[model samples]
Target: MTTFKKSFLILMLPLMAFTAAHKFYLSVTHVGYSEKDDALQITTRLFIDDMEKLLDERYGLKAQLGTDVESKSADEYLEKYFRTKLLFEIDGQPAEYQFLGKKYDTDMLICYFEIPKIGMDKIKSIQIQNEILTDLFDEQQNVVHFKIKEKKKSFVLIKSDTKGMLNL
Candidate 1:
């Protein structure tokens, strides 16, 4: 190769190696009906950094998620956000859930919720609307898994299409 071409290639190689790639925005949620408890249990997993950024951008609160210096009202804000962004319709009727709590695992935050008095036999259909992080991140995707008895269904929710339905 010519000297000029060799020099250009060497200079560009290091820059290319150091350049940051686009980050993938994703969250996973599981919804299961418990026959023993007669309720629907929900768990959502989200990245700590992405959730912190969302809390700050949407609520103007600095939620240092999964850190010692985290905000005291972080849980409250989180529940509020989830209540708005995540929704459910059970058997053609709107269902409400109670935010149980949250726990941090490594770089992810896992939030728990439950809807009580939902008998598995009575549910003909269940619909989920998961818009987590989609307001701030255009490419955000929420993966949802629903289980009832021996039936299981999964969906990948995005900004444009944020709802999924499962019929037994």
Candidate 2:
């Protein structure tokens, strides 16, 4: 694991809210088409406190994210949230991404996903809609980076422009 992944062991609390002076809400999602695995691997990094707040508001469950006292149903809520907030497509066909799991480092929650059995050779155009955290924070921005073969591209997604298509 990378040092960033190891940072989850260091517990830290998040700011209750962003002030006018600090108004950026962001998440980074990395998607790579793995030739060896014949799958698209995804890792999304989000603030643990933000996710917990959403969970509490939606399911009335307080998820301690990286802590030992984290709710058992936390994963369930994550699954539901991602399914509703994110979507991926290969070419023009809808691609189904399976939620692998999640981990926490510091105040960030990293969620994992995989599009199984998807061959890299079959991709020409890709589409993505990532609305994570937009419901809570008006300024929430979801950044998606995709890599396939030797080509790579990225997108900045916001509430109004949550969906984007890339031609390779």
Per-candidate TM-scores read: 0.91, 0.85
* RMSD after Cα superposition, model 2: 11.9
In model 1, the Cα lDDT at residue 96 comes to 99
Q: How does each model score on lDDT?
A: 0.94, 0.87
Candidate closest to the true structure, highest TM-score: 1
Cα lDDT, model 1, residue 23? 88
lDDT score of residue 52 within candidate 2: 87
Best by lDDT: 1
Error of 1 at 70 (Å): 1.0
TM match of model 1 to true structure: 0.91
lDDT, candidate 1, 64-159, per-residue tens? 988889999999999999999999999889999999999999999999999999877867899999999999999999999998888899999999
Model 2 has a clash total of: 1
lDDT of 2: 0.87
Error of 2 at 63 (Å): 1.1
